[model samples]
Target: MKSSGKRGTRSFGAVELLPTWHWSQFTFFTMVDHNGNESSAPYFILIGLPGLERAQFWLAFPLCSLYLIAVLGNLTIIYIVRTEHSLHEPMYIFLCMLSGLDVLISTSSMPKMMAIFWFNSTTIQFDACLLQMFAIHSLSGMESTVLLAMAFDRYVAICHPLRHATVLTLPRVAKIGMAAVVRGAALMAPLPVFIKRLPFCGSNILSHSYCLHQDVMKLACADIHVNIIYGLIVIVSAIGLDSLLISLSYLLILKTVLGLTREAQTKAFGTCVSHVCAVFIFYVPFIGLSMVHRFGTQHDSLLPVIMANIYLLVPPVLNPIVYGVKTKEIRQRILRLFHVTTQTSDP
Candidate 1:
């Protein structure tokens, strides 16, 4: 816990925007000082949507539906891939990891948000908040790494078909995934420690329905220069660098694809459509979130809140759908699964 009764006054950086913890509206504001405890852990209140408070109860329906769909869809992908021997290949293995990460990303924040929306349980303990923050950011980083690994898988499969088997062995992919988990965990492990050291003397009222490191750190009365710098470093080194490498991997993939015959080109590119869709949905909101944080010094807008919600929700919901629809193998298997279920139920 890092909050308590009262408020203090302080200003650390430029104005920042606050997004809803779930898919809802929120107002952005600058952090100012208030009088409160220097070291005591303080609880926080979650605001689901700023202007649309009355509708939050109803909004819970859709948000909960989306969460269920996200979880079930991703979990289905994992199950299908695990059970289907044909899908034990490197590509689907990576897809399984992606789905797992998606489940984690959605689960990290959605449950508490549901509580706020449906039950009006807006209060979160400080330690729980820290745990949620770590889960969200670290899982997000792992997803980015998985996406990058997928891009590499596609590159090797298409560009160097002969080496595809050798390059992306099951063991190698497992190693890469383990490395991603390790890297993300190791990098973000310091975040909770950093925030915990600061004294939150400002208003314990958080801008979003969930705890974010940036939002949480903003309430501190003490200097958070280390937090700020280290946060930036983590973003750039992990997600930003992964984005760059994924792009490079695609560039090489495109180069290799272009050398193929017309028919070969179409077939080759089709394999990437699902991945491309996933990449866009995952990164677009991420870019939006980053830009809003970077440039949100002068005004308040819905973009920050909107982007934050989308960043967490869209990828998880869409990845499985895209893969299920675009990839023939997955699509056929899913259909067969449903058909079997229908047949069994009818009897």
Candidate 2:
């Protein structure tokens, strides 16, 4: 029997004939050689799995639409905060930071996802993939940190109204926001560095819509036990523990509110209710993703795609609407800004 072997693109033929039984053994042994010696090559793979063509189409269309709305909505918030001097308070400044972060978080992954859906191009450069992973996580971590700061802002304002001005001054708020951004970037940047160093000897296809750390690390050739542990620690600290502290801050605020007059209590709770809702919507999906990834079936990929988009996009789109409508000052300011623009544009 003639034996054939493939090394990269070049094929080698047997110089001497072997018995059929020996050829079978040779094929098995040579397969290990192919696995060990194969060089990496880029290939286009569908973002979603096979048999999910319709699912991909349906998911991509709404995701693209949501991403656009998120971008425009967050931009409007930033513009409003920057151009309107009367809105220059600690609350609105934090809101501006949140809007900026939302824009970064949503745009980070959505554009690439839309590209994959529209063009059927899922081949990401190794460096680009690493950058994308780092950016998404960094922005997400920043958002969480910003939210915690916002909670503290609210806590001080409601619980200690007289000291609010001195406590959250412009310089102080700016410093806090900058620190949050720096902290987030510093914490998340190392993850991608570690991930990129691992050898990817298997299929390069990413199972999820975006370059998630968990999904990308699954392609590693060597052991990932330590990486997974480190990831869990990061997630627990950045997201899980942050959420807990925010919750505790709110709980203290609730106790303080309860001791006040009915009218004051009502006003305070109303101010925070929108933020509470926004936080819940933002974090529930994240917690779900973590739980599912750790304890549930990893092969079920749709859960994560849906959860990721919801966590990233929904809050950005809804935040402006929720806070703008709920707060009388912000609502009137938005209307006044629009009215002035309309008058200025009249011919």
Candidate 3:
């Protein structure tokens, strides 16, 4: 099989492949492979919460509320970071990036998920599914990188307080952001390529409301050794490496803090509390979801789904709250914004 050279191109042998859409449930999409050979089962049916089929209406309430909060909260963070010139430091800039990522990530999957819940619109086209999978995973990798960047900012602020400004300049931070995007895209670009080249001969039903690389991979009848190995490498090199470096940065910060005066240490450590909380919220559910996928039995199949919801939705929802509550500058800006809105709205 030839690897993908473009966004939607797939290789079969030596012939050209193209994707076409049909109207049936079984053959919703037909992909013509290298020799112009066509195969059905190019569509994926999202089997979202089979156990809660009857309760989708009620489930919609909380899920919709969370989506609303995630959007508004992250947008507020972006606004504050943009308007408040004092908040344009490296740490807040990274926070803004994280919040913006939260918005993107939340918006990417929630619309389809809400549709799946409200309208039972579970049929996702093959090409669309691949795009969703790439967006979700790439955004996740970028968020992890942003978190790692924030950890570094905290370390510098604590360890080298005088040079923090010089170390994390705006241009450097912009480069860091670009690097994060490139790293995530480069790492996950091959996932859809590999999956598309393999002939999917089995069930096309997906286990969750959204497309995940691993979940979709399980539906392939072909040997997925390359897919699996590449996924593991992506995870280790991106998220795992990020977590490790973030931890190391904090450890070094801790060591440096030991030499500071008591008051100085308290002042320095306070700035890191929000980031630590955000990290915990993100990693705990992510790790749990991974564990469920790898080791949990069919009896606990929904464990991964629930963990994924928590992993993706909770961080975005809570990160803004954590930062708003912990950082006095951010908290004040939020309050002022609300106060202005309230005063303007009075009838």
Best by lDDT: 3
> How accurate locally, in lDDT, is each candidate?
0.82, 0.75, 0.84
Q: Top TM-score: which candidate number?
A: 3
Give the root-mean-square deviation of each candidate in angstroms.
6.6, 6.5, 6.8
Global local distance difference test of model 3: 0.84
274 Cα displacement, candidate 3 (Å) = 0.7
lDDT of 2 by residue, 21-76 (tens): 22112111111233345332232132653346656767678778877887887788
lDDT of 1 by residue, 137-241 (tens): 888888888999999999989988999998899899999999989988988889999988877644566666677788788778788899999999998999889
What lDDT is obtained when candidate 2 is compared to the true structure?
Answer: 0.75
Give the number of colliding residue pairs in candidate 3: 1
What count of clashes does model 1 give? 14
